[model samples]
Target: MHTKDDWITTPVTADLLRGALDVERTEHGVLPHRLPARARAQCSDGQLAMAEAQPSGVRLVFRTRATVVELDALPTKRVYVGAPPRPDGVYDLLVDGRPAGRGSVPGGNTLTIDMTTGSFETRPGPPGTLRFDGLPVGTKDVEIWLPHNETTELVALRTDAPVEPAPDPGRRVWLHHGSSISHGSDAESPTTTWPALAASLGGVELINLGLGGSALLDPFTARALRDTPADLISLKIGINLVNADLMRMRAFTPAVHGFLDTIREGHPATPLLVVSPILCPIHEDTPGPSAPDFSGLGEGRLRFRAMGDPAERASGKLTLNAIREELARIVAQRAADDPNIHYADGRDLYGAADFAELPLPDQLHPDAAAHRRIGERFAELAFGAGGVFADSAPPA
Candidate 1:
């Protein structure tokens, strides 16, 4: 058991956090928000609200000389009505940009969701503590990456020594938005998410707006992107739009245009890359709303199956292939007028051949290994020499 006999308790302040746009003070502690309160208030979907608050790319970053560190947190774990119990959320610690330690705060709140009825119930619980020991002596950059999927409210920070907000590394800020894949779904930890890894590889500071099941090209999200400061930007689209069956081509075309227009209003010359969906066999040609496959629920496994027919495509119903083609065309057309805009086929990140080796376990999102591959591919394609985003990239 960890105690605070000789420890110094420090309040977790907004200045100590990175990649969070805003934060809400909660009874347990501080709840980080990827989307600002204004954007959150414009929407009513509980799913989107929850996704934006999960802290996919957020972390507690500071400089400290402490060898022992403890973080008190309240993590809200999501529990599906029929799925297996989730493991405790993992908090990854990095010292001077190297992985130093990892820990998890056990026993927090639970949010139970019934997919069949689209209903959810939240049960409150007390905060738990995470302790990490054996840090290198002397002042070192410390980063405690919050859990990617769990909604965590930080209560307090206790260390053997004092800490200060870390100095900015002067890396170019890269703001990205996407679906669960970018939100770190199926990722091993927060930092291993595709966007996070890609940001590290690209030598960019990341502000991820990747909300799971909520990247429907909302006006507020576009406005958030418009207002956020970024040297580079990207959007991994199509997956959530198709899986949600949210819109047809009629709505998608203008939605894409409007989203770009809004962001360009603030960053007209910024390098903006529009990425289409990666390979998903079920949704490659078939349209969605995807349905849950409860056949394996008894074995604590759940899967997804596309419910829309291929015939729907003739009627402009969205599919991965259609979305990819349309996105490519849109980017090409926009690039003629906006030289900084570009396009990348998501297939380049994870396609059929790659899928053969690293399959999507739930028939939708990529697993941890696939996330690495996607991140690596994205880094090479977006930040490598001559890549679209390489003009101002950090020295390799």
Candidate 2:
């Protein structure tokens, strides 16, 4: 029941906001995963704190314009929401009181809504906020009906002013794709999701295609990216493949190529970055159930089993290391001709060193501090020094 003039602001404080990395014990003493020094300065201690800090549950937030004023041109609208494990739900979007799009937020970390179907033809100021930007655009009135026990908070709403019409013109867009890890799992806020963070840091318009539990290199996903508009593009793969044991080396290599090939059909020269997964122990050198034993689930206290038998490790199955090696080979071969294409191992953003210092709270997904670490690293590497997007970026 808030309005446009309310101006939601995340408070800041000097006290330390407990981070996800702070929840567990590690081999190298208690790891210290902290927010980027800059983030600490912006968010109040209370704002930095998580509402449901448990490791096994999912938390999401859905938001969009409450009213739209000017509608000279179709503005790019976005809705930001946080994530948790096993997030499954349906989000319906509407515009001008008509159904425009429909989508699902399967369980994972991050969820985003982008509204970009038809041109804007309404008046300005803020006409009842166009509904649901996190789902595919074309939706009219935004309404999200989620399953019970799933927690969500409407965080923020954003849109770009209509651009002046031009005869010979096109918009610069960024198309990014990745797995649940990229989807912002366990991150504290909508703006903190690594892709969102990177987009904010990079100062580029983005279509976040990060699907939780759905980055399995599906042909549908590749086609989605292929048809989407983008000036720059990136695809983060590997982690999900390893954890799910979806494909072997032979199938993986070809799948990666095919996925890229599909995208290339649409954005032939756009800068494309292929990112591998970040550090994850359960799938680092090991296959996964990635499952947790929540035998002791109390009212709000959920605990999980962290360690598994060594025999499981020796099974010679898919692991993060294995995925990284395969990705390297793929990029090495592809980069020769596609100079615009690039590769980034997930670890470079948050690898063994970071994990050694701050093991993931549940040994799978990163905590808030880890998210900050990943964000800072991504800002440095992906956006380059002195990037402006994440610096002055608004809340998601």
Tens-place lDDT digits, model 2, residues 202-273: 665445555555567877567667766666777889776765566666677788999999989987876777
Query: Model 2, stretches more than 4 Å misplaced?
Result: 1-172, 299-316, 385-396
Candidate with maximal TM-score? 1
Deviation from native of the Cα of residue 6 in model 1, angstroms:
3.4
Model 1 residue 218 CA deviation in Å: 0.1
Q: Against the unseen true structure, what C-alpha lDDT does each candidate score?
A: 0.92, 0.50
Local error of candidate 1 at residue 294 (angstroms): 0.8
Give the residue spans of candidate 1 off by over 4 A: 1-3, 391-396
Model 1, residue 60: distance off in Å is: 0.3
What are the root-mean-square deviations of the candidates from the true structure over C-alphas?
A: 2.2, 17.5
Candidate 2 local accuracy as lDDT? 0.50
Q: What local lDDT does model 2 show for residue 31?
A: 19
What TM-score goes with each of the models?
0.97, 0.55
